[model samples]
Target chain A: MAKVATRVSYGEALVKYGVPNENVVVLDADLSKSTKTDTFKKVCPERFINMGIAEADMMCVAAGLATCGKIAFASTFAMFAAGRAFEQIRNSIGYPGLNVKIGATHAGISVGEDGASHQCLEDIALMRTIPGMVIINPADDREAQLAVKAAIEHQGPVYMRFGRLAVDDLYDDDYKFELGKGVMLRDGKDATIVATGLLVQEALKAAKILEDEGISARVINIHTIKPLDEEIITAAAKETGAIVTAEEHYIMGGLGSAVAEVVCKNAPCPVKIIGTEEFGQSGKPAELFEAYGLTAENIVKNVKEAIKLKK
Target chain B: MDAKRITELSIIANKVRKDALTGVYSAAAGHPGGSLSIADLLTYLYFEEMNIDPKNPTMEDRDRLVLSKGHTAPALYGVLAERGFFDPAEMKNLRKFGSFLQGHPVLGKIPGVDMSTGSLGQGVCVAGGMALAAKLDNKSYRVYSILGDGELEEGQVWEQAMFAPHYKLDNMTIFVDNNGLQIDGDITKVMNPTPIDKKFEAFGWHVIVIDAHNYNEIESAINEAKATKGKPTAVIMKSVKGKNVSFMENNPAWHGSAPNEEQYNQAISELDEIIKGLEAQL
Candidate 1:
């Protein structure tokens, strides 16, 4: 199957899900082409608002529309939406618990040659501090479609992060989307690789490599970071005795931090967080992922190291 | 236009000033300068302009108000209390523990507040959203928002300045309280966005200038906004930092201050005299 960017999938899903849902209104801050919200604009021009280059105003406007019972979605790059408009999201949308969905694309180091200026590594950290914010990071086109639909169905504020890179679909049309449930892709007992966003595919590949080496690894796709599936993560820790978390985000406060917070309390297990350690340099997505140690090779290496800590 | 109604609104505006001071004095903290500056504009909207019911503030077709300079919540809380959204007595619990009134305007906690606003440069843009929603839903309701002169420094204000006219939101009106003073001192010194009117014009807004304290002018400006059809309106009102109360008038230190017993007594007595004289005329 050919690969598709999650942002492109998101735009396609908006028209599919937004047509029947008449209350759906989309706002973009001068990045409709890049974020793929232009697809929504073409179909629903009356319901779409181009908020120009102002991300802060876009957030405030989204919050205001929500007050009037409109299911508002504001789209922008992660660096602008989650970073420039942090307080607007916190106070206007999250604090009020309004029905606003933030469609943030180009959210990680995979933004390629746009470099550290466009790459958003601290968005999860900034969004996590806001109260009542639901965080969703889709792993592939299939999950991205599910995440967009889920964000539309859920009531309160949701920040849905997508990527600049096109990824292969992991699930078929029958795959059900749940808000906080983790999907176990491949089962093993030696160790569990908890991954999110584009890193989920790498985890599955790492599991295959581990299988060839006579070692078993469990691969779990954790799309929602907040309201985490505590049951699945704890069970994985107890069953595998060691966990390795991977993401295309910063090492400090993305998926790794969220999983660590869950596993340490219920099941104390040795965990290795695989993520970008510093700002990204200008390069191709492949080179950047390799340089930042966010590859299947690294995940396989970490899985071996984690199995050693299974003691 | 009519002297009788002007007298009545004048009395109400003075009372609003006292109500705001009372809330601030009770809380021992708040932004009183900008609150006092925008009181008359707020009073005119609640009393004579807006299509709202204090009894049923959440009416679907009701007009919306967003105070973007949220530190001045004392003014909004005062106007809301006088408009019968809540008991005037509850406002004295202003910033006290367990009070429904937050330091800034919160939508659900208070009866009449349409949008939650505290950060500068956000409320006006939100007001644009409310107006756009009214257009989208094909409702006849309108939106009104007030911004402080000092708040013009925030970049988001210009963003919305570009937004409203591009969408051609004729149902919305923006009022900039050009009070000349900020906490640090004069607005020109802090960060001169002095060409406020020209900026709006360049951004495609129908611009109007008025004396904020003039009841007739305030009413006319809003009417003109309603009449203008293709774009949003921006009303820039020349105002004093602190409008009433002799000692606080034109003073920057009183931007957010509580009056002690003697000062409070003096301020109340002076406002009481003005209210009584206006009542006599009525």
Candidate 2:
């Protein structure tokens, strides 16, 4: 078995980039330690603002800072940043097309212990619906650091989703990351497994398992969900007749739905979406992943079904 | 300030009240009560106090005025039109489809609107951000935001109140239109935000309480705000829900309702009398 590389937490990645970017200001809604921006706060107190559970005010204030040419990153749990401050994000940041990076940590069922209230399963739908919003779900800590740097340079609203649990790194230290591009990790012909966030690692694992069984499975990392890499996805769909989408989000209006929208519009193909069909229950992260059908085993099963349907 | 000039501003305020009423009435929708109540404050800021260019609305160094209680956009539009930001003829397009004048203030659509604000409690925070930006840029531009007393019930307002003081945004001045009525009923019944002055003072702001309709006090309070430094100022302007118009005064029904023909005629007469008194003083 191939050894998996060590992964970095999104919080650690933010601190590494935040130290070099003086114009970068971080705002936390009393979840500094939880969201991992506390590392940045400790290093640069002047650039950090702990807004103490006021997500709406933080969103607006970030918009204000962005208007003044400062790259402001507002951090909170995905539920609060995406759900609580929905209107504030829509009007203050999205309406003005401000360069504000929203780091929504504890996304999806990975926020296991905190339960459904903290797990933001619907953030992608809410954020993607807003005009000019860039949605990014980094696969690992290395990708998250690159995503943060890229988002800071991007001149519009961007929502970077990160998980609470640690995952194996999918990319090398020197791997290049772009804003609106997808990366193909493996080549195959029978079926394609397109995934994002923590699911990227799962999809890669599933592809390896499928390769052993004499079935060729292609693995694609769709990090940037919005402004989706339709060309790559379309080409992959045409090359590999069937596609399976895996994500740590709800089946509706997330990575799966985004891919479906692109493929349905551009290239119609047999597709299967693997994600949570109901609200997540309280359990260990690994347990929840299995319970919610968000495992590589499930991806392998869904891909086989999709490949059968393709024939 | 000279008495004659103050009276001239009073006359302007009266005309603004008429314009606000007529705009709301013609549109068949708007917050006429609060708009009328805030006319003097808006008139005092735009015509007499603020250093803004009607031609260059987006000038970097121009003083910014945000209507936090943006439902009272008719009041702002009336004052901005009187200041020649746009033609007064456009005033008739209030709340109409495809008009620059929306139901609420939208920036860039209308000149002199610093921020698009329809959602209450957010405009003040945005203004605070603008004030902070001005300080950072080392510009002499001041930011003035007028909020509805009822809108103060929003928790975000207090969050911004705390933030403004922390930043020492003395370049910003916040006015609370204390008309005491919201859409449902009295502000106290809806959500009491009493002791508004102490609330600002507690938030580390320089508090000033005055009659919002009185032009002299309004002008003087704004002048006092300019002199004070190192902290933001909150002027709690005591105003009636609907000022001058007899049928609408303190009536919550008039909060968003336009006046009918007879009611509009009587309201115009009252405003005319107030304007004539100010003209005589001028």
Task: Please list the C-alpha lDDT of all candidates, in the order they appear.
Answer: 0.91, 0.86
Q: Give the lDDT of residue B179 in candidate 2.
A: 91
Per-model interface RMSD values are: 0.7, 1.9
Per-residue CA lDDT of model 1 for B9-71, tens digit only, reads 888888888888888888988887888888899999999989999989899889999999888
TM-score of chain A of each: 0.98, 0.95
lDDT for B225 (candidate 1): 98
lDDT of 1: 0.91
Model 2, B9-38: lDDT tens digits are 878887888888888888988889999899
RMSD of each: 1.3, 2.8
lDDT of 2 by residue, A222-244 (tens): 99999899998999889998899
DockQ, all candidates in order: 0.80, 0.48
Q: In candidate 1, what are the lDDT values of residues A245-303, reduced to their tens digit?
A: 99998999888888899899999998999998888988999999999999999999998
Among all candidates shown, the one with the greatest lDDT? 1
Candidate 2 ranges with C-alpha deviation above 4 Å: A1-22, B135-140
Alpha-carbon lDDT of model 2: 0.86
